[model samples]
Target: MWLVSFLGKTITAAIAAAVPSCIGPLSENIVYPFKVSDNVRALVLTTSALAAIQADVQEKVENAELQGLVQNNQVKQWLDQVEMVRGELDDIKNRYEKRLRCLGDRSFNCWSNYWISKDAKKKSTEVQELRDRGKFEEVAIQITPQVQEFSVGSDVVPQEEADLQEILRYIDNDEYDIIGIWGMGGVGKTRLLRRIHNHCKRSSDFDVLFVTASRECSVEKLQEELCDEHGFGRGTGVVSQARIISNYLGNRNFLVLLDDLWDQIDLQRVGIPFPLGLVNQFKRKVVLTTRLVSVCGLMEVKKSLKVVGLDPEHAFRLFKEKVGNETIHSHPLISSLAIDVVKELNGLPLALITIGRSMYGKRDPREWEDAIDLLKRSRLNEIETTPEEEKIYYKLKFSFDSLESAELQNCFLACSLWPEDFPIYKIKLIECWMGLGLLCAFDAQNIYNPGYTLIGKLLSACLLEEEGSDFVKMHDVMRDMALWLVHTVGIQGINGLCKRGLELIKCYTREVVGFMQSGRHYLQAKN
Candidate 1:
């Protein structure tokens, strides 16, 4: 019995330790019940106790399964947290990439802006330089008082000497307040005026005699000129200056020569005290030269002299003298052609002189034929077909024929497009010609150079007259000739060139449209 009890106590102690380890301290309080004989009961109780412990172990296993479920829930939460952190990290990376892209675009735009600004500044500087050069050229060509020193020829034995003498006698007798000399261009009107002026200057019958050329003929310009010639300082206004001049010349006998008058004169409107009807106090003799016959009638002069061209015999004599008397006698063909050409020139003194000077050394029949042909062509092609076509065409052709280069010929012909008596701006004219591509073949540096050179050549050839600082004028006949060239040559060539230019502009516009469309599409895709 003692041995069994000792064994049972050892077993019980083992159970207590194992049970606590498996479950908790409360597992030691549990027990198993059984009834049996003393020897058998002890064996049976041991078996029953083992079976109960097995049952307890099954209950502990169920509790352990519950704990395992709680641990699995905690692990799942940790996994969810890791996934959330990964999502936040991804968002940060995307934001940084977007900001970097924007910074790159800004850097590119900065470089493009710099280049655009540089190009604009360069273009502005070039334009300013061109404008300055144009202004300098304008100042250089200004007509001033020094041009009066030009040696205008005198009429020695004019055909209308009797008429001139009669007019002078009438002026001497104070028959008319103003006398007008009417004639066509190059008909010796200026020459006659110069003769009259020289005669008046030699005589002391008048005080304060003055001569001035009326190119613009503006009332203000006339007043300014009067003040300038009479030794007056810059006056306040046109009226004041005119009044001062009238007062100065009121009591004096004066002779004034107004050359190249295009419009009728209004002496009263000019602030001259000379009465609108008639005045005897001033005793002023005003002489004028004009191409208009209506101007002569408007003036209502007491005596008017219509200056006609030289007679055939006189024209031949003038031609012979100019061509050299020796050369005229030696060549009958030359002399005959010269006579025909002069007759064709309508006996105009300038026409005869220009032709005589041009044909001075040339005795070739072929050359003479070429000149005659050109003259005939010019007459047919003239825009304003004057009755004096044979004369005017030949005379004008003589000037053009002397030019050496084809470029010079084209440049001279280009001037014919302007209207009759139109004042041309030199720089504007050059710009027009350049726009027409006339200067395309020239060197880039010499593009404007040709214009300056052509202006000099035209002036030297007497094709252009400098009217003022920035104005040049061509003769009526020369303008007509230019029109003819435009209709015949420039229309066809320039029109084609303009069409090509338009096509090129269209092509560039199309390309720009395509580029713009592509840019818009790219922007849309990015958005």
Candidate 2:
């Protein structure tokens, strides 16, 4: 009897020890009914604290030593590697802990204990690994965050993988030399360049610098940006700036993207080595966006890619995204009409977005109908756009202004005559242009080559889009702008006023902004 009592006491003590460990921390099994709440909470807190420390140390190692650590650094790479490992361990802990809460009241079952023990073991292993890595010391070295936000958020439009891949290929491949993304002003060249820039920075294959060329960019400004990217202080003279930028970049594998390049940029003046010499050493690349193919030729690009507008289905998708369904789907008939109007937009994304947003939040189809009508008739000036839409018109107009010659400008405006989204046959367009006396440089029958060339120039400038093999179509916005320009600038509107026997058209600049006195001058202008 004494022996039986001793054995019972021994077994009871063994079960008591196990109860607080696996089953009690797990909090599900009724068999192990003791409250070990303090122990469980302490363990959970300890694990989280360790993780926090690891993160703190990693950030310090990054910010202190690695300037662009997230983009390129051994410390960043090691932290990422450790994080992935910890993530799997975290998944295991989460699954078991969640199940521990949901487990049924099966007192005799060993399965509960089995899962609880496994979870405990995993946590222990994780904590040990972190401890071995010197987590506490590393985090304690830097205890506070220096920035207001952990990371900035960006929303990029869904881009075609093919285009991005093509860009990546060019940037990576040793075969290609200079890469140029040539398109019209508002065709998302800058956006594409941004995407490429971000990717290259993250990839860390080559150092990347992005520079924007304005209508009046100075050599000193260009030199300053290059120097800054390479960690050189500003220099006073243009030559000094160039020298600093060149000496820094001469030996490194780097990419310099000059966005919105107007004329040929002298990279030599910017302290950039010639492409041939750099290609031989570091296999670096130079990418730029411009409206002119002639600019590509002047820069001597080996590969040039055209950025075209979105397709019909994707165009409507973007339009709907901007407008939302409430405006278009408010009526069945109006939805159909909206689709047709979107088609007339000729799949230009920027125009669709601008026009769509102007019609946002309106439930009535009449507002939409008015929008369609205005879009059809008015060119650049007369259309009613929200404040944000002004930028679009400005950019599109810049492309218009960038035309090489006045003849090309007139030829583009003449395209406004065709109805919205109407495909103009090459032969027919050339004939019209021929009689307009713009294509007089080439014979009417021989107009094919020059006509094709002119069409290409217009298309490359994003003034027009290709419809098919032998025809072209202007974007609805482009056509509207053309007509608007003609009416306002061609004296057609003034001619109409003169036909009605109204004499003088007074133009005022200094009196008030955006003021025009044409119809019986409201304040008796003295011009």
Candidate 3:
């Protein structure tokens, strides 16, 4: 009996100690409903506090999302719960507003009042808990384990691999904000960027945004793409969109990959956070690929990497791969002749691929010999691109020369009339070809098949690139070559107006700008 009494006394003392710590908060809920008007007032106050916190949290979430970040899972759930609690509170308020009166409308209905009061007290507790939980120190978190995987294939030669490593090192360095990759047209700048983009080893904190600023890419168009990605509405003017983009990207770490940039793009105008100092916490980066070295200087790049032509050994390997072993080994001398062709190509990847595909299945040594002589004679002395780049165009010309018919050649050359990187509409281009007597069929409607056939041949020869079903675009190098041919071969009626080199075009642009500013006028403008 003494042990039983002692055990009961100890248990009672433990229960007394636990009640205040454990059930003290729960006890408030028990008594809150009976407080009537106090419960409703408390509920309103808690709801207001929760709503303010929700707005702040919502703003943080939206800003993070605009910076290309995803919200934390816990944060997302909390938001959902907040929404649910808001709906419940609204229902409680509506029920209280429609309260019934009993005892000849002299007093409130006891059961109805108790029911509404109990729900309000419960919801007030829930809202208070939510308000406390919504006090997040950081509303967004970096997405984890982001792996961008790219195939490191045979196409990425030793030099390119070295270039890739160098770029990766720059990305790792804290100092480099804007890294520039510049080379001649078709020297694999875009390809190198692709490798960098898909590389799985890059930092996961950085959200890589790849934008191709082709020769024809405009600031407005670029903004629209960014706005669309950020879920911002467009048709707002460029300034408004720029402000929106600047505000959104200002808070996040990002890597912007701008490919094939022809001119200096205004980073400020485009709304990309620029000139990111070492002091800045956000480790933002901009990697741009351009053909002009001057553009690197203009953009104030921290480090500039130039992608040059492939070396002779790798060049020949790429050429032979495209030409195939069967064709090269068919005749003993054809292997030696293939080396001569690679030499004429000057190790340019575009030239090598174009000429190699053209030479596929050819077993004749004499044919290879003739190709070498044609390449030797095809060099243009006066051109805007460097002497090295000129070699690429002349080497690519071998493919143009090998096209089956004169009509096909004209049709391919005609595509150069469009600006660089312009997407030439297929049917319109075909109609132009038909108008220019480049293609003929039995009926007007039947000309499309031949036009498409010519386009296929051009695409196969690597002259024209297909841009979806309705459009085709000329590779910048190919367009340059066509323009060179237009000038050199005296394609009548298409003179200096359309025949000048790319550098000459840049010079002309500067001159026109100067002329416009200087108020100069010429009655007769010479081509």
Query: lDDT values of the candidates?
Result: 0.54, 0.59, 0.73
Cα distance off (Å), candidate 2, residue 63: 28
Per-residue CA lDDT of candidate 3, range 226-316, in tens? 6544444332477756665665667767778888898878888887766673435887888999988999999899999999989999999
Q: Residue by residue across 1-527, what tens digits does model 1's lDDT show?
A: 44544554565566666675666534423211000012122333433443354344434433332221111333334334434433443443343334233322221232333333333333334333332322211111111122132235443445857656865775676567677887777777776776676566556455433444444466776666665554432335765555555655565677776776777667665555564223565577777777776777776665677888888988888877667766665566777777777766777776676567666666676666676666666565545654543346546567666766656666665554444445677876676456545554358766677787777767755667676667677765455444443443332233112223235332222232233233331111100
Which candidate leads in lDDT? 3
Residue 266 C-alpha lDDT in model 3: 88
TM-score for candidate 3, residues paired by index: 0.62
The full ranking of all candidates by TM-score, starting with the best, is 3, 1, 2
Candidate 2 regions with alpha-carbon error over 4 angstroms: 1-159, 227-230, 277-280, 379-527
Worst 10 residues of 1 by lDDT: 135-144
RMSD of every candidate to native, in Å, equals: 37.2, 23.2, 16.0
Worst 10 residues of 3 by lDDT: 518-527
| Total clashing pairs in model 1 | 2
Considering every candidate listed, which one attains the maximal TM-score?
Answer: 3
Compute the lDDT for candidate 1.
0.54
